[model samples]
Target: MSRSLFDVAQSIASVERSEIRRTTGRIARSRQTCCKIMNGSGSPPLHRQGMDYGESKDVQKVHAAIQREKQEPRVGLEPLSLWLIGIYALAVFFGGAYLGRFSGSFSGDSLDPGTVPTKSHGPGPGGGGQQQTAELSPAERGKKVFMSNCAVCHQASGLGSQSQGYPPLAGSEITNGGSRRAAMVVMKGLQGPVTVKGQKYGSAVMQLWESLGDLKVADVLTYERQEWGNHGGPVTKEQIAAFRKELASHPGSFTEADLEPVPADANLPGGEEGAAPPKPGEQAKPGAPPQGSVPPATPGAQPPKP
Candidate 1:
């Protein structure tokens, strides 16, 4: 009975040893699978694994980027085309030819041969034997003179202040009057009542401009006659000179009564020419009325039909 019990105990100890070995093998396999899933490899601890491009999405993209960076970029100069080379060569040849033909010792005078080479005369009045030319016309010069001298009282527009006794030159009968009367007024001056353009003006004293030269006085008169719708024609320096001689004895200022009467057949230029008379049988064509002239109004005239 004692021998049988000892044999049973030995058999039980062998079975336990086999069971422990099987459990240890299963634990080792489980640890290997866990390491592979967590670390992306199943290599031994502390031993580096070869890079597996297909192992992970992130590793594959990184490897591709590195490979692209390592490749050298293509760079080189290409020779110019045959047509372009020929064009450049032609431009160079033409440019050289142009420079050689027109250089003119680099003095830059080859193109302008007509230019004066020497300074023979300075640019001034009567220089180079040329007559001194007046830049302003007589009327234009007279306009400047009137603005500076007469415009203060008469005004630039020549419409004087009637209330202040400054007479209007524009549309004035005195302006269109004969040059003799006009010249006398300017040289010797005038005073008291003066009717200009039908407006009665008085108590104003016009100072004499006797010191003004013949040309200046003549220009002023001419400007006054021609401007402001007063077409009395031009006044000449010769006319002013003759008038000055005639008025040599007259020293004092004149009144409105002293001036000569403007006749119907005045000697002024631009006067109406004699029109042809009506024939024996036919009615004559009516002449155009004179400028600034008004016909007498009938007592009870009806309005003309439009």
Candidate 2:
């Protein structure tokens, strides 16, 4: 607050003196103009009166220039607009490519319920069957599928190899059941499984056909159920489809162990249920027959009972 205070006061005085000098210069200019008139210079044409150029005229000209500039669009923005359009075009192209790649492999659409037969099926086991319809002809379709897929494993004529362990499809109880145990069995392949024919199959495990589309899977299965020397009912592709749909989330394929115990009413013998013919030593009742009423009795006939 000692020397600093004096220096600050001196600096303020110097700035005020400079500003006073500039103000006096402008006043000197005004006085010079008055002196010019007094000395007969007459102030050097203060404004050009009637000369087509004044402040108002200059302002009007500037307005017209601004309107002209507005009428013509600015040129620089065009390249910017082009850049924006290019970005939009690239976005659309990539979007289309993404959608195409995502949906291209959808497999739900290739289903064929009634597939054309490739080779001959000759004849099937059962001729007239219960009231039902087949997606594909059982004998023909089953034969083709069996030959193509199952025959390699189960063998031709639906008989599997004994040493190979693949069980026979022909005469399989799984194929010729009264109920739909056959279809259920096919849906879930067997392992260490006993078949409808009452035979134990221990060689190879059955495989699941889950990857086939609903219709094709159904058709192939329908073919198996009704093929060969196997007299069974026709299977529908829809039933197979529905079964697979129900099992879509199942962790693993079905196995014979998962099957419900074979029903008592399932796969009953085809004809009337009759006990086996009596063995020797079993006697016929009195008046049962005129000895040979059994018709063409065997040559080893026993002596007549008293």
Candidate 3:
């Protein structure tokens, strides 16, 4: 029995030795293959190939995720819709058309709806179609001059601003008096303290207007006298000329004191010998013939027989 047991043990040891040799051989082959691959003398092992395939798949997934998250490029982009371009074109066309339709010939006169453009009338036979310009009256001409020069001070209403030291001209004793006072003030101007219509004004100084010529002075005075319900008589250029000659020696502006001596009702020189017939309800001047009265006989002629 002991001999048989020893034989069985021997067989078992041989099997174990064979198994260890087989594992050692497998390990050595793996090392040799790894070394060959490191030395570039062998193909890549199966596990390396499998790992590379897995890594390639992971890299592709990462690249796909990055591409999916990327924003669209914006630089140099253009509008793409034909409908948007059509709308823009229509807006420009209608805007230009509306301006052309409503623009009134692009003329300054067209800005005023009430202003009518004057038609040019060509000369025709019998001189019937010739354009004629209506002449402005002395008062009308004076209005233009006043608006340009004096309106800033005296105002358009003829009621001067008292607070600003501009005395009113409407119904003022000086203005409604005679032509002499008005002409004197207008030609040389007024200075210092002066009273008008019982109000005192002296803050503002009236500048000389003698350079405006005799006709302009006369016209402006005539307009002022007749305007603002003033009953003063009309002034002539001749009268203004005469007054200018008389006042030539009088230097500088006049004060209220200087004008005090002149009579209010005094008439300027160079008046017509015989005044025109007074209008109805108008008072005639002293020593003047009555309206529609017969003329007196000459000194040598006998009185007319009854």
Candidate 4:
């Protein structure tokens, strides 16, 4: 508790003690009456009844604090909510903009210079598989779809990290594609060394993410497939689950031949996709670079000192 609150409690306890009450009573009643009469009312008495003032200004301070607490907004998010939102927001925001720039050739079209998925080009070929449910946030509903399946090797970002022999998602060929094609790929994991956004990404067979139910898997796949510039179209949870059901007979990972790129103008991959490759001729900043290698673009991007 705050020091002021502690002091107020202490003062209240003291006042309740027999000795303190006796002491206050011993004070000249005539003098106490004179002070109250001078003020026209016994405000000090009323204040003590509510809360005792150990110091002269404590009563006002306590009342002010109560008033301030009452004035605060009731609908504000908690710290955890703020953090989850912040991380997801940053993933979509920075990740979207970053991915938009490296879309092979279609990078900036849908994710152009702003947030919010751009307009659609019309229902895709398999439009029946496009319906999505409103039950959960794209991320929340997508979690189950992602966990039982997606967490296998690509881990999360869909980009799979190099340390784990997976590619990065900040820029990935798969994330930079269309919906139908991406959904199919989700149902069937990827394989081989592939070229994403003009860069080569070689790898072993990846696990299939088709284990989730259609809506659950579809929504999640759609979310990951679309976010970060892999535009494509909406992958219904039903679509994903159905594919998983179909593939139940053979339980092995998929190869590169299993995937196909979505069409262009389909907003296939929606945004720019890629970590800004460090600029050439740029030096690392003072605190940049782990151990020994220099950081790219940390220098020279700054304007010359005035």
Best by lDDT: 3
- Candidates in order, TM-scores: namely 0.44, 0.40, 0.50, 0.35
25-127 per-residue lDDT for model 1 (tens digits)? 9999988877895887764344234434544469668687557554454566555699999999999999999988878867754432122233345566647
lDDT of residue 295 for candidate 3: 78
- Winning candidate number (TM-score): 3
Clashing pairs in 3: none
lDDT of model 2 at position 40: 70
Candidate 3, position 191, lDDT: 86
Model 2 has an lDDT value of 0.59
- The C-alpha local distance difference test score for the whole of candidate 1 amounts to 0.70
Predicted structure 3, TM vs. truth: 0.50
RMSD of every candidate to native, in Å, equals: 24.7, 17.7, 16.8, 27.2
Q: Of the candidates numbered 1 and 2, which has the greater TM-score value?
A: 1
lDDT tens per residue, model 2, 141-175: 55555565677887676788776677777777666
Ranking 3 against 4 by lDDT, winner = 3
- Candidate 1, which segments miss by more than 4 Å at Cα? 1-134, 260-306
What is the model-wide C-alpha lDDT for candidate 3? 0.77
List lDDT for all candidates, in order: 0.70, 0.59, 0.77, 0.55
**Stretches of model 4 off by over 4 angstroms after superposition:** 1-135, 147-152, 155-159, 226-232, 241-253, 258-306
How far residue 276's Cα lies from its native spot in candidate 3, in Å, is 9.4
